[model samples]
Every structure is written in structure tokens, then in C-alpha cells.
Target: MIVKKTDNGLVMDFPALPYHKIEWSPQLQALNLKQPCVIAPYWCDRLGTPSIKARQGGRRQGELLCEIKGNRVLLYGSCHLYLKGTIYLP
Candidate 1:
């Protein structure tokens, strides 16, 4: 992954396929608790829609509604996304 330090924070770049699942490490989670971040797709081969969901007690909660099309990212739920991003909590 290529990470760039920005004035606001950091921008990370990585290649991913459809249905790719990204899990956060414990250390990373401890660093950014209740902090807001942005995720966006860059130079993707195809368009994809991603959803973020919170989990507790080994059960998955409802999916945070979102829509991604072209270069626009729309978040309808309490979750956040830029181009196409999702967050899963355990």
C-alpha cells in the first residue's frame, strides 16, 4: 500500500478487487477511536458500491447504507465514504 501524508491526515492507496474485505488491526483501532476518516477508490477498473457495518457479540449489525457511482460517493446512513469505502467493526 502507498500512503501519503496530507495536511488533514493520511491518504492510503491500495489495489483491491470486488468483495475485498479489509480488517483493521488492534493497534490501528486504538489509535483512531471515534475519529473520522475518509476512504476512496482511485483508478479502479470498474465501479463498486461498498457498505459499512458495525458488529457486536459475534453478530453483524445492519449495513450502513451507501452508494458509489463513477467518482461520486453518497452516504445515506451514519457511516462515511468517499469514493467507495466501508468500515467493519468487531
Candidate 2:
């Protein structure tokens, strides 16, 4: 997957693959009705670990850590940064 930030919005590029939507059953609706769910095989394969520990660049470089939780992507090492929000797909 490739992610790019443009002047208007963010762009995500991925190889073509099967996509499907799972409708909420009555039982599921009773549990939660606020959010709808869809499945993307490509996206599923791109799922990242919740926590990562590694180093980058020159010998003096510090570690580069990344975490993925729900819809948020977090990074921590010499600095801390995160991307948290909602994304719409059609």
C-alpha cells in the first residue's frame, strides 16, 4: 500500500483485489448500530502490527517505532507523531 498526502486530501493506492461488505445481522445490530463494516482483502493484508521496535539510518540513528490501533497510526522514537481520524471509502 502507498499513502500520499495531496493538497486536497490523502491518497491510498493498493493493488486490485476482492472487496465485500458484511451487513449487520439483527443480533449484531443489537450490539452496535453506529458503525458499518466492510472488508478489503488488500487492506487486510496490509495490516500492521500494534507495536514495532527498530532502528533506522546511520549508526547513530535512534529507533523508529510504529503502532496501529483501530484507525490510528502512531510512531515513536526520537520523536512522537500520530495520525488519528476517520476515512471514508466507496
Candidate 3:
């Protein structure tokens, strides 16, 4: 992960998959409510780990865009950013 300034705010470029909410059952919620849960074997997204471009070039990175909240993984750290997906590529 790298630290970069975004819109005048410090943001993190996490090399993690874009985890979108897949309808949680009571059992799942119980586990997730504890913060950070193991993803199921079948739970996956093909384009979730696409290439990402950082402010400076030459370094490898994954997709920056991901769901921050409401059907997305909730991220915590130096800065609290709701997992959001990247914008359309040109």
C-alpha cells in the first residue's frame, strides 16, 4: 500500500480486492460484525483485481476503485475511507 494525497486529503492505495456485498446472512453478519472476516471460497470478482494507476508511474498497483460502504468492505487505518471502485478507464 502507498500513501498519496487525494483532493487535499491523505488516502491509501490498497492492493486488495474489491469486495462488494453479496447479501449477508445472519451467520455471515455475526462474523463480519467482528470486523474483517475471511472471504468464502466461492466469493469472488473477476475484475476486482484489475490494474490500477498511482499518481506516480512505474509502480505496480491493483484496482483503486472499490465499494467503501453499503455493499462494500469497510476499511480502517491511518485514514478511514469507504471502499469505493475506480472510475472508468480511458
Top lDDT prediction, candidate number: 2
TM-scores of the candidates in the order shown: 0.22, 0.30, 0.21
Candidate 1 vs candidate 2: which has greater TM-score? Answer: 2
Task: For each of the candidates, give the backbone clash count.
Answer: 0, 0, 10
Task: Return the candidate ranking by lDDT, descending.
Answer: 2, 1, 3
Report the C-alpha lDDT of model 3 over 20-69, residue by residue, as the tens digit. 75443322333344322222111223224312222211232222222234
lDDT of 2 by residue, 1-90 (tens): 354455843333323211254432322331232111122222334553244333222223343333445765444445423357899999
| Model 3 quality (TM-score) | 0.21
Clashing residue pairs in candidate 1 are none
State the displacement of the C-alpha of residue 57, model 3, in Å, after optimal TM-score superposition. 8.2
Instruction: Tell me, by TM-score, which candidate is best.
Output: 2
Error of 3 at 82 (Å): 28
Model 1 lDDT tens row, 1-90: 454455844333333222224443322231234211234333122223243221111122221223346555443333333257678999
What is the Cα-based TM-score of model 2? 0.30
